[model samples]
Target: MAGIYLHIPFCKQACYYCDFHFSTSFKYKRELVDALVKEIHLQKNYLQGETIETIYFGGGTPSVLDESELNRLLAAIHANHTVASNAEITLEANPDDLDKAKVNALRKTDINRFSIGIQSFFDDDLLWMNRVHRGDEAESSVKRAQDAGFENITIDLIYGYPLLTDAKWKSNLNKAFELQVPHVSAYSMTVEPKTALASFISKKVYPPLNEQQSASQFMQLTDAMREKGFEHYEISNFCKPGHYSRHNTNYWRGVKYIGIGPSAHAYNGFTRQWNIPNNARYMQSVQQNIIPAEVEELTEENRLNEYIMTSLRTIWGLDLDRLNAIAGGSAPLLLKAARHHFDKGWISQHEKIIYLTQTGKLYADAIASDLFF
Candidate 1:
């Protein structure tokens, strides 16, 4: 089954650390949504009529769209595609947008999953990040969504901000565990170039993220979640039994997906295409019956590298047999080089399947690079 991803490229305000392709301007909202609908129709055949098992409304903050707009987009998608009856439809929401009315509206739809951004559930941390939502709003959002019958909820959390103490990090994790959220995706704060946080660091206005604090907080998270019987299925993801994010899992498993709207990407095993990042240009192009996007045909080496990069990041790891199949038996030397990692106890191999050990997980990206053709 394939997946579909829609990128809504508008946010209420910019987070200090955000580098995502979003603008705080709502001037282009209606046009952008219309363009997204048109793009959906334009790209309907991209996945080759595969049953779409996952539909993700990711962002800029998908919850930013009002109810009617979201319904229109979803209706357009259903009208154009063969969506599965029980597809895992996910909406990426921010805490401030999860009010009673929005939650009710979402519950009325087929959107069965939510990935709420509750980056740090402390007032100080939220202020540090310049997030519009407060600590109370963050907690209330989850409770409100649950009250509105959204049980398949996951949340995003950030750890190790300079303003976030270890105690606060533990509190954040404990809140999720206490609330019995089925899935959690956590990340260590990394300053990206051109972001406000980057500028602040460059000017020594704010202290840098404490790497040691982040590492310790990560270990604390893993241990805490494990104790709560949550499976550390992927490096940054934890889930209760059978509650993994299907859309994200499909991406990790290298399933074909079509991404819609500005700055979105689509892949179908051989070629990858991305829409132009400019919202105004995207709307004009779609209005003129054009799909404003760039495409690239994957070379043999690029395909191998892509597989290595995505597959090695998950618990499934890399399967030599699968790699051979994807490569059509052309790159024996690539798999041959990985034998040393297996011999050195960095990776475990059972016939054609090779997975990382706890130690090897630390060096996963490097190992993948080494095995890349």
Candidate 2:
């Protein structure tokens, strides 16, 4: 099965730490929506008639689109692709955008899941992050969605920022548990090079992120979620059984998917492509029936490294047999590279699978890179 991801590249305001491709202005919203629909038609054959089992509306903020706009995009997908009867359709939303009217409007569509951005339930922390919603709105939005009968709900939480103390982080987790959300995606705050957080740290306006604090909070999160019967399925994701995000799980398992919209990425088994990150250029090219994107043909090394990087982050361990299938004789070298980690008790083997220990997940990226060919 394949998946479809639509990137809505407009947000009402920019968060201080966000570096995703998005426009705070809506001057070209209609044009962009039209271009997205056109792109759907243009990329119809990209998935080669595979049944689309997951349709994800990710963003800058997908909730910004009204009913008509969202319907237009989904309508185009249904017309052009073979979607599954039980497809998981997810809409990424911000708390402030999910008012009563908006939630009721969404109930009219086929969106069976919601991924709400509720970074914190603290007004002071929200202000520090320059988020558009208040603490109260965050709680109320989820309740409103639940009242509207949307049960497949997930929320986003952030940790290890200057304004987020350990106590506050614990409160955030407790609040999430209290909400009875089926899924929770929590991420440590990292200062990307071009984001406001990075600039503030460089200028001494904000303190540098504490790696120790981040590590401690991650342990806290894992322990709490495990105690609450949530599966730590991925490094940054936890969910009640059978409630994982199908779209993102497909990504980790290397399923083929088509991405629509500016700065969105698509991957078939052999090649990967990403759309132009500019709004005007993407719309103009799509208007002319052209896909303004760059593509890369995968090499054997590329495939092996990609698998290593993505698979190691999940509860599913890296399959040594799969590694050797990608390129014969690759597993021995990888095992040699992983010896130090095994000696440190950071990794363990069960039959043909290599899984990260609890401590090893902290160094997952570095270990994967170290094992890369």
Candidate 3:
């Protein structure tokens, strides 16, 4: 089974800290959707007939697309590919877009999951981040989605913002737990260069993030989540039993997936490709029956690094047995390098599986790289 991802490149407003490929103007919205539909047909065979088990509608804000447009895109995908009957279709939505009517409209489709972007539950944090939705709207949106019959819902939360105190961070997690939200994806706020947040900090318009505070909040999050009986299945994701995100899990497990739309990526377990980031250029190229993408053939080292990067972040640690076959018997070299961390109690090996300890998860990337052969 495989997956499909469609990037909607239109947003009503540019959040202060966002650096994703998007345009605030919807001048070419119709044209872009048409191009995306064509791209779907053009790339149908990319996954090589693997049953599509997941379909993800990701940013700039899939919620910005109307129900009719979304339906058209879904129809195009179904017409071209052999989608599984019980595929886990997800749409990444923002809080401002979820009204009773819109949520009801979404329920008419095959989308079984909703990943709402509710970055924070405080008004100050939302304002500082220039988010379009207010705190109350965030809560209301989730309520509406639930009322609309979306049982498999996930929310995105951000912590470590300069505006968030330790108490506020805990409150955010506590609110999600109160809501009985089965899945949650949280991220530490980081200022990317060229983002508005970076510019603001450079000019003293906004306070900079505190790394120590961020680390403390992450520890608080992990502990609170454990107490609430949520599984830290991935570094940034937690879920109740049986509520894990099948799409993202498939991604971390290294299943093949094709990503459509401008600036989206595709992987086939061998090579990776990404479309050009420019929307105008992408539409123009696809208009001429060409796919505007750059491809890279994966080398052994590249594949190993990728496996280390993704697998180490998940509850399923690196499988030494599978690594031996994929790495052509050089897997022991990787395991040998991991002994230092094992001795330090940062990671443990049991039944040939290597997993990061709670202490090790804080430095997950660093530990994974150290074990890279």
* Least accurate 10 contiguous residues by lDDT in model 2: 159-168
Using TM-score as the measure, the top candidate is 2
Compose the digit string of candidate 1's lDDT tens values, residues 118-222: 998889889989999999999999999999888999999998788888888889998998888999999889899999999999899999888678768888898
lDDT of 3 by residue, 1-373 (tens): 9999999998989999999999999999999999999999999888999989999999899999888999999999999999999999999999999999899999888889999999998998999999999999999899999988898999999988888988999889888988889999999898999999999999999988887887888899999999999999999999999889999998898999999999999999889999999999999999998998999998887888788888889999888887876778767898789888988888988897888998888888889878776
lDDT, residue 314, model 1: 83
* Candidate with the greatest lDDT versus the true structure: 2
**Residue 92, model 2, lDDT:** 98
Clashing pairs for predicted structure model 2, backbone only: none
> Against the unseen true structure, what C-alpha lDDT does each candidate score?
0.88, 0.95, 0.91
Cα RMSD for candidates in order: 1.7, 0.7, 1.1
Scored by lDDT, model 2 comes in at: 0.95
Q: Which candidate, 2 or 3, would have the higher TM-score against the true structure?
A: 2
Candidate 1: stretches off by over 4 Å: 328-332, 339-345
Candidate 3 stretches with Cα past 4 Å from truth are: none
